[model samples]
Target: MTDTIPNPESEGPSGGWGSVKSIARILGDDKPSPMVLEELARQNKPGGVMCVSCAWPKPANYHPFEFCENGAKATISDLTSARCTPGFWSDHTVQSLRGWKDYDLEQTGRLTHPLRYDEASDRYVEVSWDQAFDDIGQTLKSLPRESVVFYSSGHAGLEASYLYALLARTYGNNNLPQSSNMCHETTSVGLQKVIGSPVGTVVWEDLEKADAFFFFGQNPGSNSPRFLHPLQEAKKRGAKIVTFNPVVEQGLVSFVNPQSPVDMLTGRETQISDEYLQVKAGGDIAAILGLCKVVVEADDAAVSTGAARVLDIAFIDEHTVGLESFIDLVRSTDWSVIEKESGLTETAIRGAGELYIQAERVIGVYGMGLTQHSQGALNVAMVVNLLLLRGNIGREGAGCCPVRGHSNVQGQRTVGIAEKAKLIPMDKLKALFDFDPPTEDGVTIVDAVKGMMSGQIKATISLGGNLVRAVPDQKAMEEAWASQDLTVVVSTKLNRSHLFPGKKAYILPCLSRLERDEQASGPQSVTTEDSFSHISGSVGKRTPASKHLKSELAIVTSIAKATVAPNPKLKWDEWTADYSLVRDLIEATYPDQFGAYNERMFEPSGFYRGNSAHDRVWKTEEKKAVFTTPKQLNALSFDDAEGRLRLITMRSNDQFNTTIYGYSDRFRGIEGTRDVLLMCREDIRSAGLSEGQEVKLVSDFNDGVRRELAGLKVREHNLPRGTIGAYYPEANVLIAIDHHDELSKTPASKAVPVRIEA
Candidate 1:
């Protein structure tokens, strides 16, 4: 079946769900996957099944009608009956495929066989698993291990990620450039710097007991729907849930819990946030500073009037430091400056502060929205500062929560994906494999792209992801791809990455987590660590898409054997043939937690990885949770210019990350078209544009790139002035490579300044 691109003109304005034309434009010209309907059927089955996308098990605790709209869409996407067999690659050359749209490319379906780029034919031809591994091994053997960079995506399983890291380390390079570097690296960097750990200090259960919840720059309704339930519960309990984001996300203000039986049956929706404050773009640091100022003022007044105690004196004196400096900074800063910088009035800032002071416990939850900014690290530290003031850390229902995107992204970092100049993972690899791993720090994702573009790097082996679309400066990334000697992609379906093949490119099809993994022992179960540090078993419920397709673990093992001589002490074949052996190796490597990895996962509900922060055991050198003082008192704010606005790139309700599941974002009233820019009515009128006016938004970055998204209809959203919103992947073009957090190297996707043109 030939795929069809949707016409952009047929899509209507950005009011409530645009007309059919907009849907077509958003989906491009691709035909609906036959698997979509099939997947929907499975989703609506009597007993809910596991989603193949995130490996999220069907929660049994909730009512029968527990699925969210996005969950249903994710299930349908996995069930898509698209197939891109070896013949399709044989028919189309890499050059020809390059011209195809991203939607059409993925619509081709799951790859059926291992394929290698045949430069002579200019096409990807089918190759046997053995030959493919042997060739990849030869390539690795030929190059200095430092030259071979292993890139991992969030979509990969824990087993696959572990193997990828092992392969790279075994081959003598720790150059593991991963997807996390682009997303939540700021959280890891900031939290570690302040609290001496990369993970969040709170568990999911803590959300329920918190008196007040401070949500910073995250829209759970669209990003992680599962979180909506907890927020809903918090709201129902009369807890004040305050939101701080540039855009007034519908999910944060109110949400219809499709999982709640009464809400689903009666079409009832619950209010999520008691107070939603739209802070200026890139102004999180300022807003937080303003809030801290209010806290400090309230405490001084309380002490003077003898009304009530504002400061947690006992907790502060026992567990923290730098209180005097923090208070001094807050006192020194004036309300006028804070209001100007945060775009929030003194009343709103004080009200937020009053809520914080009155609450017995408060939990601060944030996502990439808070981390992907120029002052991302400081913003994080500021949030930590607020918690420290209240003695929130290591206490019940009060701490820091960095809501990670991928299911196992955090776990990947924990296992050994560090790109730091100094870490002992390489030394551990040397002890385990009896081979000296590279001591030199490896390139991160951005660094790898720069290296490839500058001809310092030769080959890139991506475990699973659409790297080209995910990274910034697509044109530069494409150029870097053209310069590479070889580019290997291990994936289940065709994506934008497959089209951007190098001179010699290979596409190796692998098994999805939902598909049964048949090893010599039997069906295997993989474990994933969620944002809360809960390690759960993921067992496949569906049959393999194709018998020829190999498990990612098997493929990685084969490649590893082909690349290096087997260690006399370790049995690589045994581990590959049985996943238990791999688990045993992991348990042996990290004995502190996974002493008996196989036994623990078999339990119906898996175990929680011990979090030292959960019990208030501060692991800092001083053995106390330290209060970090903000370097600057004023919040970071941008000035509004003619035709210029600060644009925040967000996911549509129907989308997740780069995968455009469907065109309709019900919450935003955006339908069919993904190109529409969201701007407040006043901002639109100020720019001399009408509701449905065609316009070009040019980036204010040094690169001076322009994105032509025509005729965006203006909606009177309760967003901050001088700020607008756009969907990602498309808007990704507007973000420059240099616009990144200094400490974390995370791209500032949330704070790109742009101007609309007629």
Candidate 2:
């Protein structure tokens, strides 16, 4: 069970029968019947449940089946008939359940009641909703405002997210950290500083018109299967596609649309990437530096010879600042260093650069691979720098698209989920609520862990997310979490995070995204924002898993009402009765941002909440797009130390963020288990190891910590030299809690220093 099986790798393209089989398996095992197909019809419709899966934008036009294989898995997971009722909780102990794998722990089924950890019996005992809320309020009231951490996740829709943020701010705590703190904080921090926009600028309709795409550090096959359709469509239109990553992903190489009748009938896959460059792990900066070097040098040659200029000279002079420093940095960087650091030959970099400059319009797409690193924010800026060289942003078919992973994470931030006081306008909040909100910066996931370990934070109220499994230094988080005074989780199902019961812990069950959320007003709809900034509405029609479960809006508002002294100005009761009032408050706080919030969210084709950068308007202090100069060239390219190998933690095909759906990784061809290490043949031979050999991986960092992950079986891959890959959550233990980007405070989970063993 511990060792991964060496199943034959899929020779066919991504997403053909494999996807169909997975859909069948998930539906047949978890939810048997064609009823799910009927639900799928209403999945992304104007009045239906939103797929609480990956945040890939729903298409402008709806199809028969609007969801993907993983999306179906997520839906089936929520709508499964199996339930972990009161009897199961009373029978199991937290200490025993902690030993279960993430997959098994979740497969136990949906929680049916609000439960409190009883230390006397060492099991979770069912508690009445009224008593649980009252006891939680008492604990929070006993603690200092600064000592409480209100952590929200992506599962809750916009109304719930907005309420959760308001709850935190009203209680005088600015510590509103969510799942975005792990993934796209770099995108928010990096893109805003450089381009005056925090989100992706490209939409699917416009992206279809692009002449070429430059994909950096994203694996659509595993991370986002829905995105592969666009890549496939673009390829069919004969648009050039180039990819840069340490491993050659199957989806980027070739893909067969499982839904396409012609594809299924012919069994032919459309070629995806015109060119694939195997950049070394943590070497994206060097690769991007090389790209800029090409375009900059080309521009210099054009200027000298009076030939057509490669750089967008007019755009540079008019729209942006810091061009001189950017040019100087690109020109001064050594080609040899770029080639060495990127682990690609100079010829390869030059060829990729040549291809890049030929396209009139391009879409630069990236994902966690770019953001989860030591220089993550800088990594984002570097991509923007390259795009600026060709005037890619604010154009017809070009811009930086940081493909977000978790669902509604961007939407959560759009409403109010932020740590910094400056991000949200406090003056507007004060004007509407008649009460001053907290202005102090809040603790991030990293800081929260440290605070918990030091006994500085006493209480935790989570909307959703598995904190114990998601954070760096897994052992440390598990140990530190239980030291607090109280812990409360608002979720649909049980997760590893629920196991960490402090002095008093309660798991408050909430209605799942697809379940009907009825208030006094009637069944209500919730809103969610996608990766491309499109707002949409979802109305859940399914029956509630349990009558005891409450809506997140009710839970958050009730908690706020009980914990914080009643504010006469804020209508906690009315907001829960009708969500429109909540939207009104949100719009009032930022009138220009979410004006007419209720009317626009449910449009047949969701409206885009436009980014200023898309219109060539800069929101920065300088009122112009700025070029970023990195403090160090090719920083953290991870040049090898004596026994070190650059380790890249990746997600399996059946996994989404911290949630592992199954044991098999269909894309990489590993089955039955996730405990495996994948490295190039050369690395395996050099390390004196063979395929299927069970080996240990010891992380090597200079922080006086050497973390070891054993029971990992070795398997040769086509990955670049000196770099290996392992499944995440398992490998999360190797990352030190302190290893993160200073600007974003995002844990560097993508790349770590490790040494392989025999």
Candidate 3:
């Protein structure tokens, strides 16, 4: 095939120095200085220096080579020199900024001061910190407790997250909606149904020893590049790696290790996966069922032939429940239906099953692609079933691994950040502060958006996210924000959320985690949990951009103090003044894993949390892990109707979640734009379309909600037939709120069926 992929030159500086470095690495002209300087410049942006999440405060003693291309972009974008002062907001009305593209808004600059909407001037005006706090407090106090919602993004530090949760619960409202509700809530919800916990069952070390690794619906190259190292190590160790996704990601196929001097100098890329299976969009369930069916058949064959027993009969008999039912379901599943729905032949399914059976230890890693479908919860249950069938759980090098996005999303959940459920920590709060906490389940992100749209939620306090851009159904969320009684956003940089102004909106400037935070107590070291559930200390190397800027912890504390009278028992002031105290409380709350959080975090390598499943100590009610049998066999699929294709949304290498680092998506040949869509050669021909054709894609869901954009040249990719991919945020306009997993409330951005009009 001709290499017509667009050259990196067409893309802007959005990739910063990392783009040049990646290009050099790709072309075998690897030079480190230029890229390093570019990265340094990117980090030393106006407000603070932003490091890639992976590069941030490593174990103080270890020389870790865990950074990747996407990690560099995340760091560079965080450290950009952009600044959006109150003067800028004063000059530009909410209506004016709303006209700018999402990238333009964020790239404008970091927010320098707290701002509040001025009705007379019809623009955001700078306000005193005290005044901003008072305004927010008064508005919140004026509302019925149930009418206010507190929302969190994944980027916030653990301290900030803990405080945000504390503020909402202390205020007698559990109406907390967070970013997790939009991403892996399905894993939590589904896993909780099967296992007792919501977090992953595997540890990082488990990858090294696993006999086989199953990657389900996860693309690590762009989303979580840090995982590449362990995966590469596993590949080198002869572990059979199987990748199942709707699209074939190049990163999964091969990855070059930049950390190895020899490999970097030689420009040799390591072959990653042993096998790749392109399952249909939302067809993971079907593919998993087919695997289970193969396993059942293999077990039956082994028993009949008196060869070797493929089934872990002893493990199943002693450790699980519902095997008979699961076995029956798998035995009854039709191979023809499984093959048609999963887009995989029975042979391939049987091969994968054989690998699973032969392997002594196995691990299944997944991402949002598995959690954002209509049957997302069920999909997770099916994965557990496969592990259970093999007696994989509660064993070394075996269990489920959900590669979470954002820095501290997992940490937030670990430290009682949920709105609906208060852990034992809340009892301590009651004992300390003497306040009766609300016991009602709080709202989730989806419910918060719905509540605002329905007018039941009158005021919103966004601790750190670009709510409108990050949330699905952009138009509806924008309308909801506009109609809210008050909208308050605490952030470091300018973003799309700043444009969605309420009648009374306030933007509070806060210190980014990379900026040194000092108060009367001392400088603070915040903590974050990695994808592997390792909690480490992150101390800022740079000074805060403005004297007025406070830490998120301080900002949240001030708001709580101003809004609610002091509850002597809880001592919120003590924890807010020093983040370590917050960590102490975290330790107390999760004593099982985080005992002595401060001392443990001081370790340079950081510390791992408890993983019962990894130790084969299942925390299930029966004291054993149970395999689940899904009621259905087929995965979700868009009908093969004329002009319709399955559209999956993806993030560019230059972007992190909703934060766009740059416009270029170098891998798929698209440069300088995220508006383009990828399609198969036959689909392009059948639709009478050519490369660079601008067309409208109307959602097959919600009565054809049409979104128009200019299409770029179509490339013949390894993507499955009738499937298309587009960059998110830009393409988020096409996802309808109604089209999501019913159980998790996660928008099905990965599998929206659409029709293209040229």
> Can you tell me which runs of candidate 2 are displaced by over 4 Å?
1-8, 32-34, 635-639
Q: Can you write out model 1's per-residue Cα lDDT over 1-758, one digit (the tens) per residue?
A: 00121112222212112222333343343343544344444432222233344323223244444344555555545545667888886568878887765656756767889888777777778888888888888887888667778888876656667777878877877789788888889988888777777788876567778999999988776666667777778888888888888876666766666444576456575766767777888777778888888787778888999977677888888877778987877888888877877888888877778788888899998888789887788889899989888788777889898887765777777667666636445555667767776677888887888788788888888888888889877777888876787788888888878766776778899887666788888887676666766566666656677889988778787888888777875566787777777777677667776767777764433456677766766677767766767665422333455666788888876666777766666666666677677777678777777776666777776455553444454544556788888778877777777778878778888878787777
Ranking by TM-score: 2, 3, 1
CA lDDT of each candidate? Answer: 0.72, 0.84, 0.73
Best by lDDT: 2
**lDDT string, candidate 3, 1-758, tens digits:** 11121222222212224345654442232122234444444331222222335322232222233345666555444445666777785577777777787777767656788888886766888889999888889888888999899888776777778778878888878887778888898887887767766778776567768998899988777776656777778888889888888776656766666556676556566767777788878778889988888788888998999988777888888877888888888888788988887878888787777778788899988898899887788888889888888877777788888888877877777766786564336676676457777888888887888898999999989888888888777877888888999999988778888777888998898887766788668888777776666777766756566777888888888899898867675566787777888887776656788887888774544578876666666666777676777766543534556667788888777677787766556655566677777776777888888867777776776455555434534545556777888878767777777777778787778888777877
Q: How accurate is candidate 1 locally (lDDT)?
A: 0.72
- lDDT of model 2, residue 224: 75
Off by over 4 Å in 3: 1-65, 422-425, 620-623, 635-643, 703-716
Measured against the true structure, the TM-scores of the candidates, in listed sequence, are: 0.90, 0.97, 0.91
For candidate 2, which ten residues in a row score worst on lDDT? 1-10
Best by TM-score: 2
Name model 1 segments beyond 4 Å from true.
1-67, 421-427, 602-605, 621-623, 633-643, 703-718
Q: lDDT score, residue 675, model 1?
A: 64
lDDT by residue (1-758, candidate 2, tens digit) is 11111223654577888888877777666662346677777887677766888888788677777778778888888888778887996568889998889888778778899999999888899999889989998889888999999998877888988888888988888898888898889999989988899998888776778888999889888777778887877877878888888877887877888778999889887778877888888888989989888888898999999999999989989999998987788888888888888888778788878988999998899988889888999899999988998899998988888888777999998888888888988888888888889889998888898899899998889998888888888888888899889999987788998898999999999997788889999888888888888888888878888888899899998998888888788788999999888888877876776878888988865767788998999887789888988776543535568779888888887878788788767777788899999998898888888999999998787778768899999987888898899989899899888888778888887788888766
Q: Please give the RMSD to the true structure for each candidate, in Å.
A: 5.8, 3.1, 4.6
